[model samples]
Target chain A: MILAIDVGGTKLAAGLVTPDGHVLETRVAATPQDADAERLWKALEELIAPMPEAEGVGVGCGGPMIWPDGRVSPLNIPGWRDFPLRERLAASFPGRTVRVHNDAVCLAAAEHWLGAGRGHANMLGMVVSTGVGGGLVLGGRLVNGGTGNAGHIGHVVVEPGGPLCGCGGRGCLEAVARGPALVAWAQEQGWSPGHGPLDGGPYEEGRAVTGRGLASDALRGDPVARAAMARAGRALGLAIASATHLCDLDVVTVGGGLSQAGAPLFGPLEEALRAHARMDFARRLRVVPAALGQSAGLVGAAALILAGDRYWDAI
Target chain B: MILAIDVGGTKLAAGLVTPDGHVLETRVAATPQDADAERLWKALEELIAPMPEAEGVGVGCGGPMIWPDGRVSPLNIPGWRDFPLRERLAASFPGRTVRVHNDAVCLAAAEHWLGAGRGHANMLGMVVSTGVGGGLVLGGRLVNGGTGNAGHIGHVVVEPGGPLCGCGGRGCLEAVARGPALVAWAQEQGWSPGHGPLDGGPYEEGRAVTGRGLASDALRGDPVARAAMARAGRALGLAIASATHLCDLDVVTVGGGLSQAGAPLFGPLEEALRAHARMDFARRLRVVPAALGQSAGLVGAAALILAGDRYWDAI
Candidate 1:
């Protein structure tokens, strides 16, 4: 069995996964927002308290994380910057193989192992959620760039001067296509999250306009809502086209909250991708929804050790 | 010693290199434009005739080539379409290890092995001649993207609605940044290659307005000429920014005749890249001129086998 720890801005979860890739036991806790370092550590300890002994452990967390040594300064979780989560975790569980990876990379690894990206030699796995993030599986091996930041597609430029990004850049794909950006654009077009449509389809009273709510609104035939998603798809498609061209990738699997937007998100994404990808090499790109959902982080983290020589790190 | 061959639109060159990466002997031949298959075969045959006894051979040609079993239909050498260059070369060599790679990939491999990209774990190598081409080395392994076309950055769209690309796409980087396109744009601005300046910087008669002529003019302080190159640089920088972002590259080494245009070509390229690359991971990308110049192809092709387990093709 392997121990899998998943750290996110809002949650801390731990699971005991089997050799055949099954999560036999799991523990969860809400990550207190803006909590101090000690609180975060205590929450993690509580999350993993129920996990049984295992041969190896994998921790998947948001980046800017240092590679190998595993230090992280995740956005949103403001309490932790340059946090040595790996060192602390390793110290907690002595004599067990421990590995840390970017949460999106873990998601990609999980998808590659047991979901949509399986059997592809070279793939790009993306998570378009509160933020856009990605990971690469090249030549059938997960790539770890020197900084372990091999995939950061969110910051790639699609529109040269469109808008200012949180990353301090203009026209970043994330700035144009992420969940918040979509909602913001929809609002500009008279879309209010809780307001719904004038002749709304099955509106729940006082529903907040969250990313999920925006997706449901599009499904209920809101033109402005649909347009917002389409705009996101267009920007994402352009960036994917650029990526497919550069990486010669055969497939791209997308997950995360925006992915839950389903066909409303994918339909326009595919259309725009088809429109932009015209070359023979890039024409064959396959964009698909990720199969594994939230559990991907934990599973992929487990695979870091359970998958054995797959890292190809030594090579 | 290893046998190395470089096939290009304009030239076919072959060499025998020592184990220490030295070219012991070489041969050159002009690749006749639009020649028939027989003529192309004969040229290759003649080029490889005088090679010394070698354990293996590596051929690097401009692509649209198949991997593992190499078949190439180079854009410039239209004499053969889908020609089995690998099969034919292997047949002649008789049981020796004969490998074929895209010339640009070979350049990347060469740069990774013995040139500007040396010591960098992940690198991008580019060739910006009649057409643009590129290759990648991720985590120190030459990436073939299964079809031997992973790094076709030339066809990646930088300007979504700008112009038509030969690959049936709109606003491909190649359409904006290639020699032909640069020359076309320069002419629209009333810059004539042979005409030089109104009070010419050192006027010479009978110079045709080829891509090389345009670069020469730019070197002589022609505003229109310099603008054309800078425009190309801007497009290139945007494309490189996208590539660097997607690949999380360490260094980008550029070769090709245009690179010889010197700082005028690079000055703007760097500026544009920096302007687009805003993220810390991307900001660290180092762009440099390619070393080994014209011979990178031959030497890199030889590296396919010479580099030992580095190819990771079987995995």
Candidate 2:
């Protein structure tokens, strides 16, 4: 069995997974964003301590990580600047093998092994949650570029002249179609979220806010919500289409709360992709929902440890 | 000795290169665009007839090729639609090895083996000629995606809202910065070719349309020509920056006729890349002119054939 841990901005998940892809046990805890490295270590140890015997441990983290040093410096988590995560995990679970990779990359591994992308040779697995992130599995191998940051499809330019992205680029796919941006865009258009004359109803505060509210509204004949969703879908399709063209992925699996909007997103996304892609090969690429859910990161991390030698052997 | 052949829309170049990297002999011929498969075979045979004994033959042609099938359909050459190049080469040069690859991909291999990318682990080789094209060397291996169409970076979206590309996409990097597009842009702006407003005389046709003309005009301080060249440079740079972010290339070795424009293109190209790539990691990427000149295609194609077994084993 492998102990898998997923470290996100909001939460931490620890799972004990078996060789045949079974999650024997799992735990979840809210992450203490302000905590120092030591505090985070203690939190992780607590979760690992209670788990049954495992052969190894694996970690999946956010962006800007150093694989050689096993250190991380995620923008969302302020305290982890140059944090030595591998050493901490080693200390916490002595005598156990440990490996680390990006969360999206891990998710892609999981999908390739057991989810929607099973048996697919070239695939891109994406999570469109708080911020967009993804992993690429090409020719049945995970694509971690020089810095282990290959699949930053979120940063792919959607609108070169559009809104400013958090990475300081203009009109990234993340900036225009991510959850928070969707809410902000709705608010900018005077669609009140339980606030004023423009208030259609109580809308959530993320892109999911628009997705959940808009899907029903569109179904019930609300033009504004339908238009908003259509815009998001088109932008998503454009970005996905570009990625498909560039990477030659056979399939793209999308996950996250925002993707739960289902056909509201996938329908127009497909249409927009068809409009943008160049050849028949690119146009035939498939876009599907991620089969693995909240536990995908955990499963992927565990896979990293289980397939450690081979994983490292690949570029 | 290795025989290298580079086939383009208008020209066919064949060379007898020694194992030590010297071109001992060469043959240049105008392409037979209207030829059938048999005639095309005859042309290749005619070119190779004058060359010294060769160990292998390497071919570089336009893409969307099926390598395993040994066939190609070049867009620029109408008669080459699904041409069985590999079969013909194998039949004609029986017992001698023959391998074919996309021209830009071959150029990338050339640079990696003996040119600007000699010491790099990750490199992107680009060709800016009548059309823009690209080749990738990632993790020290040329990436020929499932269909041998991996590095079609020219089709990558650069200006999301710019021009209509021949590929049916709007604002592809190729559509905006390709040679014909640059000339078209200059003509649309009424920028007549010459050393000055009236001194250098009336605009000529084919000669003035070359990269050399652009360089001469830029040297002569022609504002409109300089602007057009700068625009092309900036577009190319932006695309390279985005590619750097995506693939983490150590160097970008540029070849092709337009790259011969030299510093006039490189200066503005570097400036635009640095300005657009907002991140530190993304900004550290380097862009340099290809060192292998025109022979890169032959060398790269030879490398592909030589590394065939190893390449197949990797993926």
Candidate 3:
């Protein structure tokens, strides 16, 4: 068994996953606000207390956190600069091994081992949730760049004159298709968003106003929602097409809340992909819905610890 | 000795390269116009006639070409769709071994074996000439994607709101910083471009106007040229940063005509890279100039054959 922890800004999830893709048990908790080292350590212990025995611990977090040093400073979490996440996990688990990777990268590993991208040697797993992120597994190994941030697909630009991204770049794939940005785009188009803009309400109280909401509205024949989803699909298709062109990837597995809308998103995405992909081989690149869903991160983290040094280096 | 052939849109270069990085003899010829199966075969024969005896043939060409089928259809070289380039070479040299790959991929191989990226396990070789292109060498082996197009970095978007590219994408790295695009951007800024736009006179020949030209003008205090070079550098930096973020490459070797500008481009490129790169390990990634210059393709082609089957799946 392996202990897998998925750390996010809003919540924390930890699980014990067996070798055969089974989730033995999971623990969940609200992520403490301004999680300093002490608070985070407590939260981690609370989540790991009831887990089954493990060989090691695997951590999945936001951003390209440090690998060799085992520190992390996720943008979404305040006061986390150089947080010793790996050290903390090692201390918590004692003598076993511990490995950490970006949440998206773990997602890719999970997808490759047990999800939509199973059996594919080169796969890209994209998470189209509140924010856009992804992981890449090429030549049967995970891709972990120098900063351990190899799969930051959200930052890639899809439109030259579309919208401004959080990274200060204009028209990045994130800026165009991320949930908040999608809602913002709808507002800019003179449409009233069902959940208002992401900026309003209590900071943590605001709900995601894209995807499912848009899907419902489209079902009700709301033209704006239909158009918004279409726009999101087009942007996503363009970004995926670009990835296909550059990496020659075999499969793209898309997941997260946005994917719950199913064909409403994939339909237009496929059409847009057909429109944008230039070469014959690129046209043949596969795009599929993710299988493991929310459990992907936890399972992937387990996989990281189980695979050991050779696989970790490949990653 | 190994026979190396660099096949391009307008020219073909053949060389006899020994194991120790020596080019014993070289041959060059214009690529046949309106090339058919027979014409291309005849042209290859003419180019190879004067070269020294070789044990095997290695070829580098513009791609999205298929390795499994040995077919080629480069963007600039029309009428080559599904053409069996390797079969022809095999037929000509019956007892000799033959291998083929994307030109940029070959460059990466050359960089690993004999150039600036030598000794690195994970490397990227970028060609910033007529169009931006690249190849990857990971774990000291080449990374050939599904159809030998794994390193087509030119299509990656540096600025989501920049310009149009020949591949029909907006704001691709190629659109903002390739030789022709750099000159076009300079002209659009109201500068009297020494090189004409893509369709005007001899300057329209496309590949001639590189970042080096802008660097020369920058040295002369030409504001537009200075800005053009800056943009090119930033674009290149973003691309490298993204590659580092995703590939965990330790070294990046830049080649082609534009890379000749040296520090004028490198300085700003480094600055832009610093801004986008992940903090940890970002500082460790090194960007260097290619040492092999024009001979990279030929040298890399030979290296491709040397590396053998472990990397065959990638190309």
Candidate 4:
């Protein structure tokens, strides 16, 4: 069995996974937003304490980390800037092997190993929730680039001089298409969550103006919400087309909140992708929804130990 | 020793190279335009007939070909669509190894092995001539994608709804920044080659309006020509920034005609790259002119045999 941990800005999850990737036991806890590094460590320890003994431990954490050594400083998780994640895990696990990688990269591993990207030798697995991120599987293996941030498609410039990105760039794919960004754009266009055409009474009260709310509203035929989805989708298509052409990709699997908007999002995405991805080899590419859901990060973390040959090459 | 061949739309070249990438002998001839496939093959045979025998032969040819098997159908070379290049070479040289790959990929290998990209583990080598093309080296090896067209950066979309490309896409890097495209844009902007501010008498008379002429004009303070250079340079920068972020690239080496425009091209390129490649990891990337000159393809083809461990893997 492998101990798999997923560390995100909003939550911490730990799972005991079998050699074949099945999660036998799991634990979860809300991340302390303003906690100190030690406090964050304690929360993770408590979350994993109930898990059974395992042959190895694998972790999927947020990025800008020192790969292999695994010192993390995720943008959203301000509490753990440059935290020694891999060192702490190694010290705690003793003789067991410890592996750490970016959560987005883990998602790619899971999809390529057993989900949407399965059987595809060249695939890009993406997430479009709070932030747009991705992992690349090329020639049937993970592409661990110079800094282990190979498939960071979110930062790819989709619209030059369009919008300023959190990374300090203008018009990054993430700036235009990330969940929060899309919701913010919708709100700017006068979209209020519970004030949509389908919103009726008490059930819609106190609903947060989240990407989920925007997706729901779009599904209910809200004009501004649908437009928001279309805008995000077109940006995604442009970035994916660029990636497909540059990498000669075969398939793209999109996950995360905005992707669940279905046709309202995918329709524009498909149209833009077909329009932009015009190369002969690129024409063979297919973009689809990611099959693995919320547990994808844990499953992919487990893959670090169970299928190291393809996913875990950093160490 | 190795026999290296470079096939392109305008010219065919053959060289005898030592194991260390030195071109010991070379022969070049203009490609027989409008000729049949067999006639083209005869021209290639005559070009290499005088060269000494070698242990192996390697070739770098224009792309849109079936890799490894090397059936070439280069878009610019209409005489030989899907011509069996590898088969013909193998038959011509029995008991010897013959390898084939895209010419741009060869340039990448050459740069990585012996030119500007030397010592860089992750690099992108680009050519910005009549048509833009590129090859990627990641983790110190060539990235041969699903269809063996991994690093074709020409088709990467830099502008949304910008310009129509020969590939039927709008805003492709090639469409906006390739030699002919940039030259055409300059002409459309009322800048005629040899009619620039510095053009004088017979020295500039009858000069063809080409990418080179435009570059010369730009260097001599031609406003429209400079604008065209800046336009192409900015597009190159955007595409390179996108590529750097996506691949976590360490360096980019640009070759070909337009790259020789020097400051008129590189200044805007550097500025735009900094504007978009804002990620901490991506900040370290360096863009430079390719070190090898006209013989890059020949040297890279030689590397296929001389440095097979890093450059040749298909067969």
Query: Which parts of model 4 are misplaced by more than 4 Å?
Result: A194-207, B195-207
Q: Write one digit per residue (lDDT tens) for candidate 3, span B247-297.
A: 667899888766766666788889877666543554588999887867888
Q: Write the per-residue lDDT of candidate 1 for residues A1-315, one digit (tens) a residue.
A: 899998889788899998878888888888888788888988888778666477778988988777777787877678888888888888888988789888988888888888899999789999997888898888888887766787788877888777888887778889988888888889999997644433334347654555666876786678888888888888888888888888888889998766766777888898878877877778888999999866788899998988846642632
* Docking quality band of candidate 1, CAPRI definitions: medium
Could you give the candidate ranking by TM-score, starting with the highest?
4, 1, 2, 3
lDDT of 1 by residue, B1-315 (tens): 899999989789999988868887888998977789989999889888877477788888887776767888887788878999989988888879888888888888888889998999989898886788888888878887856688888877788777988877778888988888898899999998754433233345654565567777787778898898898888888888878777789999988767766778899999989888887788899999899865788888888878856653743
How much is the TM-score of the A chain of model 3? 0.90
Cα displacement (Å) at residue A104, model 2: 1.6
Q: How good is the docking of model 2, by CAPRI class?
A: acceptable
TM-score of 1: 0.94
When 1 and 2 are scored with lDDT, the better candidate is 1
Model 1: lDDT equals: 0.82
lDDT of 2 by residue, A154-231 (tens): 777777668888878777778877867876676667653332112343344542354445445544445565566677
Q: How many clashes does each candidate structure show, in the order listed? A: 1, 1, 8, 0
True contacts kept of each: 0.61, 0.34, 0.44, 0.84
Query: Candidate 4 — which pairs collide?
Result: none
Full ranking by DockQ: 4, 1, 2, 3
TM per candidate: 0.94, 0.91, 0.84, 0.96
Best by TM-score: 4
Clashing pairs in 1: A193-A209
lDDT of 4 by residue, A27-48 (tens): 8899998998999999998898
